[model samples]
Target: MKKISIQGIKGSFHEDAARKYFGEDVEIVECRTFRKVCELLDRDEVDGAVMAIENSIAGSLLANYALLQDFHLHVVGEIYLHIQMNLMVYPGVKFEDIQEIHSHPIALRQCSEYIDQHFGEIELQEKSDTAGAAQELAREKYKDVAAIGNQRSAEIYGLEVLERGVETNKKNYTRFFVLSKHNNPIAGTNKASISFQCGHYYGALAKVLTIFGDNKINLTKIQSIPIVGKPNEYSFHVDLEYDTEDNYERAIHLVLKNVSSLAIMGEYKKGDIELNKP
Candidate 1:
């Protein structure tokens, strides 16, 4: 069985993504944080790592992107998981009786509306992970404290689901990337992910983007992240999907000639889907 490394414990969304992509039969190695997930991959402790890349509601995971650059791991696959945030409590505990809630900061923010409307006075505590919060509450048998996590977490921690789908948006989903030391040979030859730093010159970004327009290559996502150790200096990460023919190569070459520093992070298969059906 292939061993997969994921950030957070068994009940985390990262683990769910791993199981969804690699199947339950695969062995799982849990890491405490996103950086450790990449470290496990770098140290060859596991075959690959699953890292959350973006959320439909919360926007891009900037920290994971930094890990991608620091680790030099290739993006071998992608998975989109529909998130179902739930409020969990100990058995026999009533929602009206709860006075405190705990969960990951992101989960709390996502369900701010529900909390404000129904439990405005509830004291919110931020934990490392949502599932971890549930596990903590379960261990302590806290009847007055609830946890905002997934239903799976409630089951794993032997907690009751006080409320399901507590997120403000019904279409909540998170995009995770499967990273491996080896790149998938069968991945999309047409797709490319690149990072570049532009010289501090007027119209530098415009010139770089115009090359893609002129060559008719589509730019899917563009994000700017700060370059560590350099105050106010940022690098642009871009995802480009285009045919890997001579035309695409020519376009890339044109952009490289003008950019200060350009590095192809990885080019792998692109799988887009709306998850959680049935």
Candidate 2:
């Protein structure tokens, strides 16, 4: 059984993603924080770690990107999990009985509609993790308090789900990356992630992007984050889906030839999305 490290406990989305990718029978090592996930992987304490890279509702998880730059791990695979935020509470507790709800800040923001409509008189408390909030509620046996988290959390903490898929947006999906100590040498027929730094000049970014355009590669996402200790210096994060044998080498060289520095973060299998049933 391969041991995998993930941030948070059994019910978290990270853990869910890890199970989805590695299967249910694999051994799981839970870490309390995201940084710890990277630390364990760097120390070879586990085979790999799963880290959430972005959420459709909240956008990119910048902290994970920072950890990618700091750690020597490489992305081996990608997983896209459809996030269904559920509002759960203790059994026999009515919605009107709730005085306050607690969850991670991101979860609270994602389910703003439910909070605004039902919990008008209730307070919203931010916790370290959504599953952690659910666990705390279970431990304290707070019947009047509800938690906005996943269904798995409800199952793990013995809470009853008051509502399912309560997120304001139905298209809520979070992208997670599987990180390992070794790079994935095998090629796949899917998207690629790369990081690069462009020279400080006008149209430098435009020129770098043109390489993709010229190669007929569809750029899916792009993000810019400031580099530490370098004022006004930033790095570009890009995602594009292209035929590996057809355009991988040429596209990389073209970008590297034009850009000051280029780093191929990883190329892995593309994520598949299931169509929502009405």
Candidate 3:
């Protein structure tokens, strides 16, 4: 069985993403932080790591991007998890009996509208992990404390879900990146993630982007992050998808001519958000 590292314990969203991308039979090595996932991959503690890179509502995980660069890990695959936050409590604990609510900061923010409309006065506490809060409440037999997590957490922790889909938006999604020591290429590869530093001159960034258009590569996402220890200079990370491998190769060939530091982070198939629910 292949072992994969994740940012949170069992029943967390990262585990769900891992199972979804790598199959349900894979072993999960839970880590306390995202950087720990990188360390596990670097130290050969696991075969690969599943990490949340971006959320529809919360935006990008900037520090994780830096970790990928620092660790020299390759993005091998991607998973789009539909994050369905829930309100779970100990068995037989009714909704009205709840006195306090706990969850990770991101989960709390995602369900802010629901909490404000129903239980605004409830004392909200942010925990390090969403499923950890549920596990704690169940283990302690806290009848008055509720946790906001996922259905998997409720089942794993022996808690009862009092409310389902507590998120403000029904279309909540998080993009997870599968990282490893080396690239694991799948058949029909057409998408890629690349990072580079462009000359800090007029049209340098535009020239690289124009090359993609000229070569028929579709730019999916682009982000700029500050280069540590170098003020005012930034590195650009981009995700590009192409219909043909030839077009992608031509674009990268042209792109490298215009950038100072270029790295092909990964070349893999694009994962769509519309996959059927399991």
Identify the candidate with maximal lDDT. Answer: 3
Query: Per-residue lDDT for 114 in model 3?
Result: 96
Give the per-residue lDDT of model 1 (tens digit) for 1-278.
Answer: 89898888878888788888888888889887788888888998899888898888889988788888888888877788998889899999997879999999999999999999999867999999988999999999997999999877888889999788888987888988888887656533666778899887788988998999888778988988777898756699888878655666898889888887888777666656576862
TM-score, every prediction: 0.89, 0.93, 0.96
- Ten-residue stretch with the least lDDT total in model 3: 269-278
Per-residue lDDT, model 1, residue 100, is 95
Off by over 4 Å in 1: 228-233, 243-247, 273-278
Q: Report the number of the highest-TM-score candidate.
A: 3
Model 2 residue 102 CA deviation in Å: 1.3
Model 1 deviation from native, Cα RMSD in Å:
2.3
* C-alpha RMSD between model 3 and the true structure: 1.5
